[model samples]
Every structure is written in structure tokens, then in C-alpha cells.
Target: MSNNTVVLRLARSDDLAQLSKIEQTCFSNDRLSKRSLKHWLSAKHALFLVATSSDAIVGYGLVWCLKGTRLARLYSLAVLPAYRGQGIAQVLLSELEQLTQSKGRAYLRLEVSALNHAAISLYKSLGYQVFGAYSDYYGDGSEALRMQKRVARYDGKGIRLQVPWYKQTTEFTCGPAALLMAMYSLDTKVALKQVDELAIWREATTIFMTSGHGGCHPVGLALSAIKRGFTAQVFLTQLSALFLDGVRSEEKKQVMCTVHDEFITQAHKLGCVLYEKPLELDQLYKLLKAGGRVLMLISTYRLDGKKAPHWVCVTAIDEHCVYVHDPDLDASQQAIDCQHVPIGLMEFSKMATFGKNRLRAAIAIEKLP
Candidate 1:
């Protein structure tokens, strides 16, 4: 090998000093501290690599791969000023993409400073597309552009519903957005609008869950679907007051109980099917096969490391994966990231629970034939 040949290797504790120096020289702000660098050097969730030329650390790339998810993130990639003209950045990025695929991840996501035109050009040249942006995202108050690239091809023979992606307009309206998606998938005549979303939220909210506006209760969601002229069934593990654990104030708890009770009563009066049982994967697959659309409550911890109850539309399923249309789209996520998200069968189950009680709830909807 030539003396200047750039060699890439896993970052190690021994290279901490040189890596720190390089980081400080490359980035004026938002530089990782030595402690963080040391932590990531050994963090299993992070893949840290260093590029060396003439046995000197010249550049580095980082990949944050969360366990049990088909996603990886390019945390950072920086090359020394002297090595700017060389293809070292491209080489490091390509290797990172390959490693992402090796870890069974389909997408490699990243956030880059919006002002960095050269870096943005490099990413675009390497097949990355800008999907979304975050305002005031950096230490210097610079905006960040979110980009993602498909690193691995999904080989599943997918069985998916023709559902259009509709992002929730608010932070707490995922349930309504999901319900609308399911309804639209079953009947294309259904309109997706914020007015209807808020309307459903008013009917389906649990009054007060946590400190926010409120979360959608399963019973309320099922009842909301039924009221819309769609045949609906709720598969739930518990028949008691839902989302109560997320509330603390006694007055809020009482209001939630009253709302849930009314919803349960309405479901009974309307002859809604309430299957009080765990939603088995096979059973869910059969429902999908029968052309039933699903609105499932899931914990967002696996998807974004935020432990909160979130609703998503189950648009499709296959032998190896279950695809969902997530209604909650943060600035970091585009419609591509939220639409037809392929979660592995096992990973889907793990993400389908919420709270310490591990509450599992799903609403199935079908068109009246």
C-alpha cells in the first residue's frame, strides 16, 4: 500500500487524543467531548470508525444503530482540512453505508448543516436525498437538513393496503390520523383533513393522559370508526380504563374514566366487537389478509427512543416484516420514513406495547361489503 493510502479502522480508546484533536480542528462547535468520544468508542449501539493516512488519524465517521430497528443514523463524519480534496470522506461514507446494510438496516439517515453546500453535494452524489429539515437545530443556530438513503433492499413479498400517508397535524393526534388512514384505505372516498382529525381527536381523546392534551383511547378509537360507518373491532388486553396510568391528577383521571366508560358503553350499544385478548401476530396477519385495516398503539421508544404511546396504521404485512404508516412525522422524518415502514416481525411485537403495564391495543376496520 502507498504511504498516503487512507486506511479505515474501528475507533479505539488509544486513538482518543488524536481523534479529539482532529474533531476540534474540523468542527468549531458541536464537537463531541472527550468523554462522549470515549463512551462511543465502546458503545455497542454506535459504530465509530477512524480514517488514517500515514498512520495518522485524519478523518472519522459515526453511525448510530439502535437495537431491534431496521434503521441507522450517520451521527457525524468529518475529514481533516488537509485531507479535504481527497476521496477520504466518500470512502468513509461508502463503508458506513455498507456497514448499515450488514446490520440489517434498510435506511441510513443523517442531518447535515443546511449551509454546508459542499457536504450536501457530496451526500447527494452518493445517492442520499434530502427529505426534511430542522430549524435552529445546531449550536450556532444553523438549520439542519435531514437526508436518508436506502442501503438495503427489502426482499419481502409485501401484502400492503393502498393507504395514503397523512401526517398528524398536532403532537397528540396520531390516533385520529391513523384512523383516517385506515378508513381511507378501505374506502378511497374518505377525505384526510385537519378538521376531521381534530373532530376525531375530540371524540376519541382520553380526556387527560400525561401533561399533554390527551391520548386516544382504544375504545374511543373503535367507536369513532364505527360512527363513521365502517365495521370496527377492538383487540385489547385490558377492558379497564385505558391511559389512566399516564394521568396523575385525580380530576383528570376521573374525566378520562368517564370518557372511556362512555365509549365502552357506546361500543356495546352499537354492537361493536371488543375482543379482549392479546393480538397475536398470526391473527393480525389473517385480518390483513381479509382486507382489514388496522390502527395499532405502539411505544415510540423503539422508533425514536421516546417512550410514549403512539398510534400507527398497519398498512401491510409479509413473511419477514410488518409495514406501518406512522401518522406522527417529526421534522427529522419525511413521508418516506413514515410511509410503509418495514419493521421486522419480532421487532414489531416489541414495539407494539406501551407503558409499564405493556398495554397492547389494536383497532381493526373493514368496509361493509
Candidate 2:
């Protein structure tokens, strides 16, 4: 194919011999063998991409899609020496990622020999970072640096959408500001005026602490805030039909059970931790009783029929109070002290509904480095 028309496509069984030839030529002793090729080409989650020039395979990359964990591993990538500067390798990688996203993989992880500057540079330019290292990882005893790219939003077409708020603000939706102070965390000059877009609410990250649901909206907003120079973790929670599916008298419990289990299972695979026990004010108060650091997610909804979504984060807990950053409340809004927040074990048990076992809450924590 012409350089302008270099087609990157999935490697097929018929192309195995050609791929093996390229591998052998590129990695003499370390090349993947025929047996390995058989396994990789046949595996369902295995991603195999080839860069073709005039219909001849010139480069290839392999990745593994681990859906339950939202992780994709780049096992090996190689390009022929003659095609080194033609950008065939880049084409292969882009197509491989497109394939990865198609399979619902979230993070793209890979190990590269520490000194392999070329490969490292390629990954870095593609937004990968060194997350860890594997000591003496290679058979030859060379250490491998583990690099990762949060791939939750990658599509062959690039980011799904450049959030309007993100374009207006220079920050991401998740960060010290989104977590610690909410929109008040942002500089006033850059914060967008409160507006409604397609039923989605918009406010300064600080405004999130103002109400329980404020925090829920900020999760996506937080992502927008820090879109530049950083990759933020995205945690989506929607209390749509799923949350209130069984509240109506005529609803079927069996359908709700099946849906709930599937949803929880998918969430856990996406790095979310499910809290089976309902969250009561006192239970949360107990967790914050010692003035210790606690990361908590709180939500409230109507038990009878109407279900409105609300969520908040517990930043600190002390003997007398639980300190929270409520985005719904403005920054000047007083810190909600647990004692006066109108939470009693009895009332909390009712409002939270965790005791009734009708609704579920979960949190996904992504530690920043």
C-alpha cells in the first residue's frame, strides 16, 4: 500500500506465516515462534494488528484484552528494520488500540525493556506513563519498566467528546480541587456559570459539596477539569431506571435481581468496590469517629417510588463530627458537622435505606501517583 494508504488491519490466520517471518527477522532469537503465534491468533481477547504497505505486512503489535479488570496488555510490538522510519509502527499501534477499545478494555498496560528508548518514547507520546517496574523481568535479565495508559475513553475516533466545561476550565473534573473543595477548588475566573446542558447540571467543583448529588455530577465534570496534562480516573454512577426498577408495586423482583447482579458484577470488574451494608449516618459517623481519613460515598433516594440520585464524599471523621466536601453547597457553605447534620441512627437508617436492603451503593477508588 502507498504510505498515504497504509492499511492497518487485524492479523488473520492466513497471515501467521508472514507475521512469524517478520518476528523472526526483527527479533532473531527472541522472536515469537509458530506455536506461540497459533495461541495468540486463536485467542478471543488477543489483539493482533498488522501494518501493510502495498498489501505486504511490514509491522505488527499484539495486545491482550482483560475485560473483567478493564485492562489491556500490550505484550509485543515489532516493525521491520527497513520500515522503521515510515511510521508503520505508529499505524499498527493506533489500529491495535482501536481494536482494544472495541473490546471494552479500559487501561492499556505494557512492559518495555527499560533502555528501549524508542518504544518508551512512542508510548509516552501516546500518553502512557511509567506506573511501576518489573525487576529482571526479561529472560536476558534486563529490567522492564511497566507503563500504563488509562484507556477508558479511547476510541479509534479519539475522545468521545471534549466536554464543554473542560474546554472552559483548564482543570480536570477529578483532582485535589474536585476531591477536597469541589468547584470552589477552581479559580473563579475559569469556572463556568451554572448552566444546564441536556439535563446535566454544571457548577463550580466547589458547588458539588453543597448537595449530596453534587459529587455525582462532578465525577464526570472532574474528568473535564483535568483533561490537560493529566489523565483522571472516571467513575460513573447513574440512578436511572436501574435504581428504581423495583420500587413500583407492579414491578418484577426477579428482573431487578438479574439486572442488579449483572450491574454489580460489571462494576466490580471495572475496579469498583461494592458496599453490601447500607450506609447509615451513625455507621458513617463511627467510621469518622476518630478524626481519621476516610473516603466515603453517600447517596439517598426515595424508597416508596420516586428515586432521585445524591452522592457525597467523606473526607475526615472525628469523635464529634464527619467533615465532608459537599459540592452542592458553595465553598462558603459551612462544613457539615455530623452532629448537626440531622443524622441519627434511626433516621439515617430510614433515609439511607441500606437497612431496608432496597438499594445499593458502591465506590471506585483510583489512587493518584
- Candidate with maximal lDDT: 1
Off by over 4 Å in 2: 1-5, 154-369
- What are the Cα lDDT values of the candidates? 0.85, 0.49
> Which 10 successive residues of model 1 have the least lDDT summed?
331-340
- lDDT at residue 1 of model 2 (Cα atoms): 24
**Which tens-of-lDDT digit does each residue in 1-369 have in candidate 2?**
235757777789999889889878987445688888878898877888788878898888899764222347787899889889877777777777767767755456778888789889998998889856767767778888877775556232211111111111112222233233223222233333323211123332222232232222323333333332122233223332233332443334344444445544444454333333544444544433422222233343421233443344444332323333333432322122110121223333344333233453423232233
Q: How far is candidate 1 from the true structure (C-alpha RMSD, Å)?
A: 5.4
State candidate 1's TM-score. 0.71
Candidate 1 lDDT tens digits, 184-300: 988888889999999999988887878868978888888888888888899988888887776778998888888878988999998789988878888888899888998888999
Question: How do the predictions measure up, each by TM-score?
Answer: 0.71, 0.45
CA displacement after TM-score superposition, residue 319 of candidate 2 (Å): 30
What C-alpha lDDT, on a 0 to 100 scale, does residue 111 get in candidate 1?
87
Worst 10 residues of 2 by lDDT: 158-167
